[model samples]
Target: MDPRIDFLYLSEPDMIAAGVLDAKRCVEVCEETFALLGKGDYLMGGANHNNHGMNIVFPKETKFPNMPVAGPDRRFAAMPGYLGGRFDVCGNKWYGSNHANIEKGLPRSILTMMLNDKETGAPLALMSANLLSAARTGGVPGAAARHLVNKGAKVVSVVGCGPINKACFTAIMTQLEGVEKVVCFDLFLDKANEFARWVQGEYGVGAVGVDDTEAGFRDADVITVAASRLRPLYFEDEWIKQGATILVSGPFNTDESFLTSARIVYDHTALQEAYVEDAIASGNKEAYYSGVIGGPFFRLIDAGKLPALKDSTSLGDVVNGAKPGRADLKERVIFIACGMAVFDISWGFELLQNARARGIGQSLNLWERPHQG
Candidate 1:
């Protein structure tokens, strides 16, 4: 008897061919995953089973030989999870990141995803995860846009025009077909212009590089904030027009007044609540829930300013037709996507299947026989 194991390798281009980069499809899959997450049908890392990942950071003032210095955005991470439901696969995403890589003309992070069989814990596919990560990150917001953005939304604003934002824009457009103008704002003016150019070239839409956050926010029908800034990206509550939708993808510094009044929604309230509980358990009450966007929503719930988080629906509810989306043209809605590993695995598994069908991978044999025996 012969034993053989082969895994598919999906290059970025091959992923595109396999439809892994399709914003619309990615959004749909993420929506399904969100519903499963809401129903407690998933298991991530940590005792809580909702931890984002285990991060390893270097010391800030290390003087040891051959030891790396700790700096901004420099770290390694291991994100593992077992997602149930349709895909029903276990996987992990491991990556290392450093800000200095930008100067070397490379992405700040190099990442990989390992999909595994649920039964024997054998590896399925080891493929490039940068595209996987970006697509899923954007797909979360795309899922939100599908369920929340105003119909016929023509004007859009984007804060932090980076790789993540690029994918966000791609996903948002799938939901808002009438989007004809895109306004972009970044700390680096050049990066904003670059994002504008790409948008115009890709979709034939009018793209403008705006000077201020308010300018990006003003009168826009749909707004997405995907920035990586350590500080908060804020626009006065008065700046957002009625019926507009805002998709907050990263850390947000915003006034509580808007959060208390808006129709707030999240990808998974359980995960958001876990963060709130962690904040409380960590002994930092003031900044506990306030440090994260979801935390602020929870704080409002505690104060009775906002409705119960459970009442605030998930995008999956809308996708599954269990709840309504965009109640009216002028409803103010906010969707928070904290990101999850199940999303990556869902899309990654789909891509791997496609890669195999199209014969698009480099196979490496794991072993000719079982070493454990």
Candidate 2:
């Protein structure tokens, strides 16, 4: 057997060429990944095997100047996981994020993904992952929309108006047909208008920008939240239409009137439970819960107001046919996912195969052969 190891290196353009921007395909792969996750065929970071990742968070006050102090959205995270089924591999999504990156003409978070061999530790591919991450992040909700959305959904309300939501819109539009309009809302009207115009240009949908958050939700069939964490986006019970699906990927706030009636679906229940366990053990459960999109529901679970974590429905279970997506029409539903590494690994594995098949990326040799040999 050849001892030499060479790994594929895919840059941003290569990733796009390799089909990383295919939201429909991303959703399909994410659905398969979710099924694997539901069948207990994956392992994430930490002992729980459901941990999101290990984050290097600098403190607010550090005595040494070289040791950087914490600022807005500054940290490094290593998310590692192994996925099973057709694509069985291990991988990690490593990223550095800082709110100040805009000053340097960089993205808030720059990411890369490394896929590895199951038996050997050598990498299969190392690729730029900004588009990969966005596609998967959007794909989860897109998958949820596939199984859970109300039939003939006509209008979609997009809150946040960021690039992530652009991908979400693409995936959802790919799955759900007859989408006639898109309402875009953001902290800045210019951003919202820009998103609306893009939607109109791409999909020929009657897209419009809205200044009022509530106005964005009115008469909408789907509401996607991927907004700022600094302030949780809140909605009134009256503003939301019946049978509307809310896909939350960021901070959110709404009254109990909606929660008591809405069926809350998780991306993966085990990960959220692991997060809850970690929070309780951290001795700051409230603050911990506050940091996540699912915090409100998880806190309610902790208080016994909501059902137990096991009792909750996950998108994975729905995909696996282990659980129903929706019980009845006119029952408002919310799907919340905090993101996971298995998604990156699965998609990365797929892109690697695609790129290899098409010979779309650079290949670098690790060694001619083992030095000892």
Highest TM-score: give the candidate number: 2
Q: Which portions of model 1 miss their true places by more than 4 Å?
A: 1-3, 285-295, 298-304, 307-311
lDDT of 1 at 164: 88
Per-residue C-alpha lDDT of model 2 across residues 1-373, encoded as one tens digit per residue: 8888999999999999999988999999999999999999999999989999999999999889899789889999999999999988999999999999989999999999999998999988899999999999999898889999988899999989988888887888888888888899988899999999998889887999987888877789999989876666888888888889999888887887788678889999999989988898889999988887788897777777899988888898999899998888888889998999999998888899999999899999999888885
Instruction: List clashing residue pairs in candidate 1.
Output: 243-330, 243-331
Q: TM-score per candidate, in order?
A: 0.92, 0.98
Worst lDDT 10-window in candidate 1: 288-297
Clashes of each: 2, 0
What tens-digit string does per-residue lDDT give for candidate 1 at 1-373?
Answer: 4666766667777777888778888888887887787667888887889877777989977769888889778999888989888789999999999999999998999989999999878888888899999999998998888778877788999988888888987888888878878999887788999889988998999999875777878898899988874566777788889989999887766678787667777787666766766777879866766556576677677888887766777776776677776777778888888877888898898788878888887787888887886
The per-model lDDT (C-alpha) reads 0.82, 0.90
Which residue pairs in candidate 2 collide? none
Query: By summed lDDT, which 10 consecutive residues of candidate 2 come out lowest?
Result: 228-237
